[model samples]
Target: MEPVLLAAVVLFAGAYAFINGFHDVSNSVATSVRTRALTPTVAVVLASVFNLTGALLSTALALVLADRFIQLPAGTPGLGILIAGLLAACGWGLWTWWRRMPSSSTHALVGGIVGSGAASTLVGGPNIAESYQVLLQQIVLPLLLSPVIAFVLAYLLVFPTTWLMRYSSPRRGDAGNRIAQSVFTSAFSLGHGMQDGQRTMAVIVLALVAAGFSGTTGIPLWVQIFSGVALAAGSLFGGWRISRTLGSRLVRIDPLRGMSATAVSSSMLFLGAVWLQIPLSSTQTMTSAIVGAGANQRFSTVRFIPLREILVTWLVTAPVTALLGGILFLAISPLL
Candidate 1:
């Protein structure tokens, strides 16, 4: 039974990765495509290749997630809860993608795990304090601050960039900006792969350890390849609806502005998160940077309605996934 459950968990985790790939590729490619820095096909293809290569950049993030996410009781975790959590997360991810909403797969996964794991505590899991710590230190802190960091850094850098490039004529400026944007896009995709892409491995390893299927919880080479490949494949497909939402609805992207945003976002991920081995939401990081870029030119250039909608989605993602995850736990508990 444990073996069966382990297999299922691994499959679910892979599915989640595939879903996450499509969900987030937009974050990296949207601006580039929007600004005409790269055609949509080229942008997506670039993201896929870069993401695939950087997928296993580090295992620290996987360790952090597997160890810190949910503290189950001693004996063994209820496989039902783990399975249900993954399913709920995947469901939420797909739903949001269909709705053209750019939601965080990490957010959905955390919410699903918390909701289901919290319910398992009723049967003999650890205290809620552990979950709280996971939320505060691991999830919430990174989620809230990373985006702000992305925004601030992007906002600050743009003015200087704008000033320095002011002397160049339109054609020269456009050429320079395109070259810079290409570099920035590649860098951001690498960072995105290192940070967000490793999470799929983390979740699967967590489930393996929790279920006692694997002796070790560390992310193995196989797990890295598996997760990375799945995510990259999803990115290749690309989320057109979400991409449109990110690329168009929020702000009209220009090459110079998009380059600034991508540069800031990549720096933040590589230094602020990846160096620290933390799982930052690429979705939020990229979107916030784009917002900051727009605001750098003029505050009014950004559309409030779509921005508001994405915020509302972010705000509700946790609790709603929590509810769904808990309900799923109940429904599946009997089988386990």
Candidate 2:
């Protein structure tokens, strides 16, 4: 890739990270805002700081995301292909965010890449369709299982936590738990930055390798530094709508419920990042945990309608983004 193309790839990847900072990262602090443990402004600021730190904290997850989910015969995708896929994901993200729906950025990105990879078949590139098997094991299976794990664990976990606090005065326990919730929210936000934010780091790495600026396994320091900053900057603005949806309309998130959900999501991310070394979707985990927390009270009280809408969005995001990415790549392939 030329310097111009490389620059464009960097910019697009950064922009995607920035959008993710607001769109996906909002899930981490939605409960904090709803429970009034942290005000909206405070939550955004705090999350931004922690997310930036987390983005820079490791390159392992970055490698996980940008590595060969769809390995090209050329080793990596071309500039045009990456741009098409990323832009497709970005468009889907912006659309969903504007509509105040909590969809998975992970799905959008994977879809975009898959779609673009398919398009490569038209240009005599290796069949990226062959990659679905690898991806099914690495990406798809985990995505299917994450929510199930989060829901069960969160539902079970909420009972013990609430029961243990049963004897403490409601007002007094609430006060102390808010602080605990804040700490958990902060940790969750950190994991959000590292796990979700690093998807963009992976994009940058793939771009670098394609551009001959870095190796597939090696992440440049500049990529880490810039992705963190871009994500933090994006988190600083326009997260309120997504925040509102996750915090309020999903289910009434009292401090305990909030803490329960936050803890579960944080644990999921931590395990994925450290032990499993996979790129899990915080949006999916958060929603599942939130549902678990709410359903623990009563099934009808959880508001199944909004969750259905979110589920629809999640179900379609991948195939839709993938389709969009394929079309965009095909349209632009001749130029590269």
Best by TM-score: 2
How many angstroms is residue 309 displaced in model 1 relative to the true structure, after the best TM-score fit? 0.7
**TM-score (all chains, Cα) for each model:** 0.94, 0.95
Give each prediction's root-mean-square deviation over alpha carbons.
1.8, 1.7
Question: Which residue pairs in candidate 2 collide?
Answer: none
Those runs of model 2 whose alpha carbons end farther than 4 Å from true positions after fitting are 73-77, 298-300
| Model 2 lDDT per residue over 23-138, tens place | 87678778887888998788888888988988888878778667756564343347667888889989999999999998888888889988888898878766667778978888
- Model 1 per-residue lDDT tens digits across residues 71-134: 6543235566677788888999999999999887888888887788877766564534456776
lDDT (0 to 1) per candidate: 0.81, 0.82
Please give the lDDT score at residue 215 for candidate 2: 72
Q: Residue 11 lDDT in model 2?
A: 91
